[model samples]
Target: MTTQSLDESGNDDTIDWLDNGPVKGKSAPTRMCLATREHMPVSRLIRFVRSPDGDVVPDLAAKLPGRGVWVRADRDALAGLLTSKSGFARGFKQSVQVSEDLVEQVDLQLLQRCQASLGLAKRSGAIILGFDQVRNELQKRRPGWLLEASDGAQDGRRRIVGLAVALYERVRVATALAGEELGMAFGRDHVVHGLLKTGQFTDVWTKDYRRLYEFRRLTDDVWVSGTVGKNV
Candidate 1:
């Protein structure tokens, strides 16, 4: 993984998740609850535990046995985990294993969860796809958020964005999961256009996306302030 120093002002984004305990804990040992403040979504926050080697694993299947540890599901959160060793260790009340590559694993899990959720949403007709279809959905009513594929053609996405401006309250362009990842969300080999259905599950999905987006932005060396809008 590539590493770059970030401006101190923007470092706060990582800190925000740490304060919130974003990792596996809500439904079971494996399922992580995505939490956020306000109507906007946040990252996948659930409970977790440190491994003997210091690995931060997402207990998706809830099969891993042990007391769970909580982190923000981002690199900075991993850094915090490393820094506050005494606190976390005390919380676990045992010799918890910590891995150096914990952050990378969490990132991969985050992407996988996004893709998997997208696939489920697509299967349930919770997602609308293609530029034209998405445009039509926009006409029906403004959606809670707008999602665009980061790898999509600029012109195509721009056209869709124009339609979204009138129909959606917020827009989020996803870069983590591109063409194939987008398609998997809908059970297709490849997909570009997709919209999510509103429900409790969807709320959690949105929050996870928001957290992933912010973490990606920070790690990518793009310093963005204010709420996420058009462009990733």
Candidate 2:
């Protein structure tokens, strides 16, 4: 199913998918940004609103009250919006003070969003942790995705990746977070491998996961190296 939203100009716009498939269930109607003029799913957009003090605040949760504006969640897109001649001011229809660290702020918020979603997935029992559990789960059913600590051991990651690849043609392996971060999500000291099962929680977690993945890619800050299985 598709969703529609009204742009700043009061014209109806259809939001397009940025991924191969639409997220299951009813997502809120999408938003159109003044900077890009492209209607996109909210998951692919970063929201900002004028604070009571007239400063532009990043509303990662989209819960803040006020007239809001959205920018595509890309490094270049946000950088352009901030650098453009009066882009944000013109869009909000006011002279708002944009934060100098807006890009960093958005990146931090997106990271937190991804971490929170992973924690939620663990609580919902939609995730399996450790190499043995993940490998066993894969044998029973195909998971939605595999997660490996950026610093995890090459041996275990390679084994799991090979198994996932054998079962699914295109397996998503998230290596942006470290083992400690993954452990925090699963309520442990550290975790090197995890499997996200296909279910309701997967739908929610995947959106944040993809956003975090893209954000890291755009910023060129993806995690690259760490000792594997040190916790084991």
**Best model number under lDDT:** 2
**Per-candidate local distance difference test:** 0.53, 0.70
lDDT of 1 at 56: 47
- lDDT tens readout by residue for model 1, 170-189: 55444455777677666678
TM-score of each: 0.62, 0.74
lDDT of 2 by residue, 3-80 (tens): 112245643223331222222366666777556888887877777776676677787777666567787777667777
- Kindly report which residue stretches of model 2 are placed more than 4 angstroms away from their true locations once superposed: 1-28, 218-232
Number of residue pairs clashing in candidate 2, backbone atoms closer than 3 angstroms, sequence gap of 3 or more or interchain: 3
* Candidate 2 lDDT (Cα, 0 to 1): 0.70
> Model 1, stretches more than 4 Å misplaced?
1-46, 50-56, 60-65, 79-96, 168-176, 218-232
Q: In model 1, where is the ten-residue run with the lowest total lDDT?
A: 33-42
